[model samples]
Target: MDVRKRKTILFLGMALFAMFFGAGNLLLPAYLGYQTKIDWTSTFTGFSLTAILAPVLAIFAVAVSGNYFTDLGARANLKFAYLLAFVNVLCIGPLIALPRSGASVFEVAIQPILPDAQPVWVCVLFFGAVMTASFSLNWITGILGKIFGPILLMFLAILIIPGLFIGATVDLPPTIIEDRFYVGFHEGYQTMDVLAGLIFAVLLISGANRKGYTHINDKIEVVVKAAIFSAVCMLLVYGGLFYLGAHVSADPTEITRSSLLVHIATQYSGVNGIYLISILMILACLTTAIALTAGAANFFERLTNGKLGYIEGVITVTLISTLLAIVGVDGIIEYAAALLNFIYPVTLVLILSVLLFGKTIQNQKPYFITLIVTMLISFIRVLVNWFPNEEVFSAILNVLPLARFNLEWVLPAILTFVITCFALGRNLNLKRNQPF
Candidate 1:
């Protein structure tokens, strides 16, 4: 708590906020509010649980584990740990998030101004910028924390402060969804920051180390404090936007999510609103894209045991992300939704298990059993969505607890862990070999 330490924590917190507040963070809450209307409170609660609370917990879990994501994941076993790491990184990096950043900026910020602009060229230019800006972990955080983070916050403040005066002008519409909390919970999956948190933890730890917090306890303290700071900032911004959305007089069905945000911004501040939001989208998306590119490069070099150089990884990831960006935001979101549904429950289980049982649960069997059951149930749920008419799958899934909430995996994962622990008894107390 010296002056320098406080300054480091402040900047780290700002950088973490910038990294998490990406395309989904900007777009989802307002749309959820618009859809839920009078039910905005309950829906926002559910959204904040996954979107805000879960990601912060993911950061804490890694910090407590005294290592990066691999150590946390290796609680199950080395193979499963590595598999989840790669999938989580790819999902948040090139496949979905990285590309969606550019695509969203194009759709929301660019296309409206330049009707003739092609997304391909915009993406190429965007990724080219990302590639050039890719720096070491500490440098990346320093730049985002000191520069982009403040500018992004300033842009948000310009729009959101005016938004508070805006209220529902029409007869507020009735809620369309019966289970508003569940709908919010389901929508929260689309944010995907919880998944990003696992990897962002790596960057945070490295940043702390270079800042000279070399003691293990000191490292955990700085990371946890910074994460809490980020969580507060996210809740404020997301809550403001969600409240603003509830007040906007627009049809959710008539407008796309990104467009809905644009509409609200314009309503709040008029022509100047458009300018603020356009700039917001570019800075927000660019901050996230840059962070993801750096994070991905770090992961690849680690995965290949340094065979893949950091610069090479950055170039390769940018190239792939550039190609995928051409598909546009909605298309990427459609694909990401399905994939996230399948993976999120499993990831949540892993994070919660580590935080809850990681200290005493020495044997990997319990973690293994719990995660496998979670994955099986989650996969079945995804299949049920894909083939809605399959009576057998529907019948089996509906029987699970929380099915109405689209969280049917929760009960089974808990039951499986308990049953496995009881069945194994003292045998479950066996020491686990270190994965590393």
Candidate 2:
């Protein structure tokens, strides 16, 4: 590839990172401060690990693994790889996180910018137009590369700098009690970016592959470095947002909205701060929404083996997501995170299992068994939540260990994966004529 081509690839990779970092990204940390209260520091740190570090690492991991993220799942078997890839596409699609981008961006940033004379529908129309434009973006990757690309980086700089500066002006609200660490650790679960990371990092890898440096090591280096760059920026911005929120929320009593940071900025830094943050957030969300639509369309096309193609798939998916965003759901972020608590622990273990036994389990059977078992547990939980009245003991997950806290699936999933892997391994060895 030409030098410029490589640069473009890296640029697209960066854009992928930016797109994953959206309006939802801006709001989660600030709300963390408001809810965690004086214990905001620990909460922020715990959240950052999943919210920032996990996604960043996953981006590089896929780059090194290969073009298909499903390949990781396939390392153990084709079944797992297929399921993971499919789930990731859906998670990043309208089934969950993607629609939330437009809904959130519109609710948190765009609508706020309108004047008293302008009706709320005007904001809705504008947001709808964004969805249209994003669909059309299938034909103009460069336009996005040039415009929203720089806008994202510049705004991130602006958003992060003010946040870091807020640190000097205010100390974190002190931890309110013992076990702040545990609270902080669980708070990280709310971000669910790790769940998003397992999916979206594939987008980052695609951008890198477009530049044509297919060598795994080279891709690994670029992915790792870029993830690091992006992670550091994310960490600073999120931490600042949380600490700054602590500063602004010193009143001990303030209404907590989804857009708490904007509210806090307006309260502390006045009108300019509010406008600045809002614009940045809107732009960030716009870029992110575009990427999610584009990515889903692309993934759908791929899964169907080019059934929809670029233009058709983009239009159809984007339209659906836009419409979904318009209708909106209540407590969307919380719902999305809760959705993650079910799948993510299993996904996390699957991702880790590959890293652990990548070479040892070249056959798909072990991966397939582990992934299927995990999904079985997760899906069972999903069904239980769906029809609580159907299950006799559904109300008593607490008696069953991790189930009480809604995390029962994790330990069992892990246990099943290990047992199955060993059983599979032992069977494979026996079939190899080695009688132990």
Model 1 lDDT per residue over 1-436, tens place: 7988888889999999999999999999988988888779899999999999999999999898757788888888888988888999999999999999989989988887788999999999989998888855559999989999988998888878877866645456777878888888889899899999998888888899999998999899899899999999999999888888887887556799889888998888887677777899999999999999998999999999999999999999999999998898889998887789888998999999989888888889999989999988888888887888888988889999889889999989999999999998997778888877
lDDT of each model, Cα atoms only? 0.88, 0.62
How many steric clashes does model 2 contain? 5
The reply for model 2, stretches above 4 Å from the true place, is: 1-13, 115-150, 160-192, 250-254, 334-338, 380-396, 399-407, 425-436
Which 10 consecutive residues of model 2 have the lowest summed lDDT?
Answer: 427-436
> Each prediction's TM-score against the native?
0.97, 0.82
Cα shift from native, residue 345, model 1 (Å): 0.7
- The C-alpha RMSD in Å for every predicted model, in order, reads 1.3, 4.8
Q: What is the lDDT of residue 140 in candidate 2?
A: 33
Q: Please name the candidate that would achieve the greatest lDDT relative to the true structure.
A: 1
